[model samples]
Target: MLLLLIPGVGLAIAVGILFGWRWVFAPILGWAMLTWLLGSLRALGKDAKPPGAPADDVVATPVGTDQRTLFWCEECGTEVLLLVRGTNRAPSHCGQRMHERTEILN
Candidate 1:
């Protein structure tokens, strides 16, 4: 999709020049700008930034607000809380141990 942008603009400009009509540049430039903005938005969503200190205060809750368990991998320093279903094997990270994470009720 990124590769297509160049040819799209080039073709638009070429047709405009060949036909001796400069008005075609408006739509072509508009389309190019739209695609550029779309690409930027997509790139922004792809890169996930690490959470700051506020993440520690997050409480994981499922639909209906049932009392769900939270288990996180102690190996990772920024491990996220997990919701427990049935009794299953504990999660791990980087060959390190996993521990249950609890939140203090404020």
Candidate 2:
């Protein structure tokens, strides 16, 4: 993120210089370069982690009809079907009621 600021500040400084506001450009350019360097160093020091590591915080729930399931609108408590997985929580279609059902999986 800080790395991205460097070019922005540089551009601003260049523009300021062209517009005769050279004094303000120096500080902006300096800060931008400093932040960019720090960000680059931090990124370089970090190591990439492998996929599906134990430290990863993903909770996998089995998807099927076998287990006892409760489907409801998390927002309104309306009955609804667990149609798909969402990034945070399951979303309901309409009616504000959770549609819950149970069936045996083959």
lDDT of 1 by residue, 34-96 (tens): 999999988777643456623233344565554445666655664545653433445656775
Alpha-carbon RMSD of each model: 12.6, 12.0
TM-score of each: 0.28, 0.27
The global Cα lDDT (0 to 1) of model 2 is 0.61
Q: List the residue pairs that clash in candidate 1.
A: none
Q: What is the lDDT of residue 14 in candidate 2?
A: 86
Candidate 2 lDDT over residue span 2-63, tens digit each: 99989977877787778766667677689899999999988766644457755644544566
User: Distance (Å) between predicted and true CA of 49, model 1?
Assistant: 36
